[model samples]
Target: MESFASLFAGLGLFFIGIRYIGSHLKRMTGRRFRRAVAAATRRSGTSAIVGVVAGALTQSSNAVTFIAVGLVTAGLTEVRRAAPLVAWSNVGTAGLVLLAAMDIRLLVLFLLGLVGFAYYFDVERSARWRHVVGALLGIGLLFLGLQYIKAAAGPLRELEWMSAFLTFAGTADWLGLVIGLLGALILQSSATLTIMAVTLTGLGLLSLEQTLVLVLGSGVGSGLSVAVMAGGLSGSARQLAYFQVAVKLLGSLGVLLLFWLERDGGVPLLLAAVQALAEGTALQMALLFLVIQLAGALLSHPLQRPLLRLCASLAPPAPAEALARPRFLYDQALEDSAIALELVEREQQALLTRLPALIPADGQVAPPPAERQAVLEASQEVVAEVERFLSEVVQRSEGDEALERAMNFKSRNALLQALCETLDELMTALDTSNGSAGPPPLSVNLTEAAHALLDSLMEAGGEGEAVDPQLLRALTADRSALMERLRRDLLRNGADLDADQRNGLLAATALFERLVWLIHRYAVLLPDSLAEGISQKAPERAST
Candidate 1:
């Protein structure tokens, strides 16, 4: 009973360590880590390498798998690239077992000491340094947990019940597989089960063959975990999860087949060769596991395209997904300032395109109030999301390009606000008129001017052309004339106009003048080079 408690306690600590390490590593890397993976996944070999490195460092292939899934779902990476990523992550997870096979108490102690000093110096206050300290503490806890498990399990061999159980476990080929799978399912971590197998092997409670079987089952368990984790996901995410499961199942089957063949005199041949090169039974088994994993990856590589096609057929992206979500502001790109800024600019452009629709067409019936309100609400949500995304991008911005991009985002935000305000003011003025006759000729002309300026700006921006500052100046040059004309008409018509009509006209004209100035301000604020680029692209697009 005492030994059982100790073993459970050690397992608890081990789980804690894994969680700590995975979470802290995520914090340290932020969304940039996902971005890096997306970029590296352009090539299968590089993607696999990234998978291995990420898996080894985090000791959680699930972490790597989900990251891949996220990038794929966001359309940041292709399914073919993610296929090797998942395959290699499974291979990378074996590193933990190898690390546990060594004596690393001294290393653990050093790490713990470093963590202590970090805490004492308050270095952990910084998010980046906090991740480092958390990782160190986690490693220390992992080693300490291993020691506890070793101590607790070592004495189990002395009991008669344990001795009998071990004897039966050795002869029962399927027992290890069943137990491994069940334990791993309960723990949600194959690495946890593999480490236990390693500990049990070191204590003489399990043989190398049994350890191998258990580890293979653990691989299957990890695959199932991925599937379960991805259950709620759709589109590319679900496909990526299934791909991971397939890869792990293939690896497990390959290893099991090799074990079956080894029993038929093939073992003696390979064991003889491995024994000559490897020193320990556990080490030999770990090497075997890694080799089988690599073989499985190679075997699975050819199926990448088929798997992708299968996933696409199985789960096509929903049509409403684009409308329901922010298409360009993906979290994966948020850490890359260039990509993120571009995405923000794209979304801002989209928002601007909707502005013209809010303007009432001459003689057209007004849209229902409910419909207008809904549109405004949706626009506000998009505005909030874009602002948050830009804030994240700016936090990571450093270079001149990033700085310029941030400034551009700010200017675009200002323009969007002005556009929304202008729309609201126009709506209010129309309401004040009690939905009476159409807007006066001056108001109509002002609306036309605003629409033209908006359309021209959007077109020039889209074409990568700088709006000639002179052209913008010309557009706003008539603003003073329009304002004076509106005021004169308001006074001359004051006796004929109701108090509400007078107020509405004044507010509407004032808002229109503000809109013109806002546009001019944004255009002027744009850097010379970008303005030049836009101007240069404009004529080409027009000619084409």
Candidate 2:
């Protein structure tokens, strides 16, 4: 009972320390880490190095994978570029496993003692150092937990039940594989399972061959866990997850085949190589874990193109992902300021075209809330990309004309972003007003007005149609007086409307009015030829 309790306690501490370390390190690195990942993708080698560093720091490949996914989703990096980072990060996770193989009992004690002193002096209270202290404490706890597990091994081996289980588990190599897989699935971390296998091997409870098979299973299990957890993701994100799954499965299974060859056919492969390189069961297991990760990297790196194709086929880019990607802006354009500014303009216009989709056209049914939100999110993503593209243009631009055009594009981009946000809020307000009870008469009118205004803006911004500044100025003219009168009348005569409906109606009208003003401002910023007379006249009318 005491041994069982110690084993469980050790497992608990091990998991807790991993969680603390991963979570705190993530918080500590935060945006800077993300930026590093985003920037590192310029070169394959740099990205790989960053990936390894990320895995080492967080001690979690899953976290690193998601971070890469997020960067891809944000248009900060391409899926192809992010693939190396995700692949190499597995190598970084081996650092902890290797550390565990060594005799670090004194080191663990010293770390725990240092953590105690830190707490005693209130180092954890400092905002900057709090995460540092927490991560250090997690390290101490992690190794201390390892020590506990190792200590309990002797007592566990003395038990008849444990002895029988170990003997049964080692009788067939495949059985150990299954055990490792299940253990990793339950723990959601292969490293944790592999470490346990390492400890058991060192204690003579399990053979080195059993530990090898178990590590292979744990590797494959880790991949399965990622695939299962990321099931809900789609598009490039899903593709990236699939890439991770491929790396793990291929690497582990490939090595497993070699192990089988060595054991059954008298072939000298990974097992022979591992035995030749390292002594002792624990050290050999750690080296094998690293070798498996390296094999995965080595095997997958050469087949990157085919693997990426496979991943894409398995999880094709969703329509929203396609929409979110910038269609016009490319890095190469940045070299030529003129081309960069032109691309920015084209991208902004593309975004401008998406604005009308926020509201359905005449006689078309309004899209469901989920569809609407997806469209809005796609537009927002493109807006972010445009902003980033323009910033780069600003830095590279040389002369006044180029600089002025970039500034003009920036201001226009800002207006477009505002318009997107207003439309989003307007949709929410309209949805609220059109409750389950049905659309109120005021809601119906507001919806129609929004549809007509968005149509006019779309036409004016379209490529084929020449910008009719006067027409836009009149269309988007101040409707404050009209909205105010409508509001007053609704309060007096809206008897059927509940409080929620009434508030929704009021908010919708206010957002619609602001929407019109934003359109007017956007028109005034149009080119001199387009805004010829209205730019001079619209501001005065808009002030009223």
Candidate 3:
């Protein structure tokens, strides 16, 4: 129990370190990863290598899989070409496991203390350096944890139960394979399970053969994580995960076949057959593992389409109404006035998240109503949620300061509702084709310029924190000026274009002007109470 505790603590720290290191590495290499994912769609051999290399460096198959999934979902890549990424990720994960299994000191603790002291000791900008140093230190702590686990497990030889288990595990191939599979499933980390197999083999309780079964099972086990991740996302994702499992099951059978062949004395078995083969020696073993992974990858591509077709065969795809889902609105974490302010900012981000579906015909910006769905839904939810949150906060707090912020919260919510109402009205007008006067035509560039100004204002309005009333007014004026300029240009060029072209241009002009009004309203929604200083120190901010 004591040993297990020590081992657990060490491993806990080690993983946290791995997480920190992974994050920094991810941020540093994100652009490269993006390009690699894009290049892989071309099916160029070099791009496939780049894909695998990035996955290994990050030590996250989930991350790579997600990227591939996004690209596929976005129609950027054919589902057929996406299979190699899965194969590449699984193989890359094997490399990460090998690396994480190495020993390292708990240097992250030392660095944390050093950074903490340096920051307090008036070292200029030391705190700013803390994040990078902390991440590096986290990597060190991760290894230290692994070391402690090793030390703790050293006592297993002295424990009767441990010895019995080990002996039983070593002697029984089927049992060992089951344990390995179950353990990997529980851990949700194939790498972690593989290291355990390697460690157990080193302790001499299990032969290399027993460990081999477990490692193979571990590959199958780690897949449970992907299954869990895909559970929330149905359709293609669910089918993809299911098919991947079938591939793994088949691959496991192949491993069993190879082992059975060796036992038949058709070929002399190497003593090292049990050990996980690497690039070092037993190139055949490495090749075998690669083959299984590649097979799984190849099988995954055609399988999804077939699976989808099979599903269709069994029961037709769900009707559009059955599968219809409401877009997820903004997070509702902003109940406290301080938190509500922050929540508004996040909701604004959510609004911008999917507004691209509405890009204008000119491709400069989205249609006004279309843009509002993403932004309006996000803003509406946030404002409503914050109002609810502030109500609770106001009831609980004692201080006048808290009370004042609550009032400001109400004002912000009102502005949010106003924006929604305005947008709803605009969309209705467009649909109704109200004989409202359309703006005059202009140069295509000028029309595009007007659309751009509107989008910027919409984006800025959604970005609630740093919003300045002066900036809002400037955007409003800029949009109005662009509309006037575009009107003049349309009159100048209207005669040059064919009649059909002229009609199309006029329709586009009307849509762009309406969108401009929508954006301008977003800027106008910013009340004095919504800005940072005003809400935070209500009395002081008001005075300023």
Q: Compared to the true structure, candidate 3 yields what TM-score?
A: 0.52
lDDT-sorted candidate list, best first: 2, 1, 3
C-alpha TM-score for every candidate = 0.66, 0.83, 0.52
Best by TM-score: 2
* Clash pairs (backbone) in predicted model 1: 464-534, 465-534, 465-535, 466-534, 466-535
**Taking the tens digit of each residue's C-alpha lDDT, what string does model 2 give over 414-448?**
88888888988998898888767778877877788
Write the candidate numbers in order of decreasing TM-score: 2, 1, 3
Residue-wise C-alpha lDDT for candidate 1, range 426-526, written one tens digit per residue: 66675564526646665676566667776655544433334665566566654778687878877787676678877777777787787787777756654
Please write out the lDDT profile of model 3 over residues 1-544, one tens digit for every residue: 7888997896787668667766765655554456457566577455457656766766665666666665544334544465456545666656645544333234545766765675576552455554565555555666566577668777777889977887777677788667767886776666656655554454554555676677777667766666777666545444445444555655666666777678656665432342344433223333444555555655554555674455334333223212122222222332344565455445444544333333343744435564456455544555554554456656665668766756654564565566455445534433333233442234334344544554555445544334554465565553546656655775686675555455555555555555555555556655544455534666876789
Q: Candidate 2 vs candidate 3: which has greater lDDT?
A: 2
On TM-score, who's better, 1 or 3? 1
lDDT of 3 at 396: 60
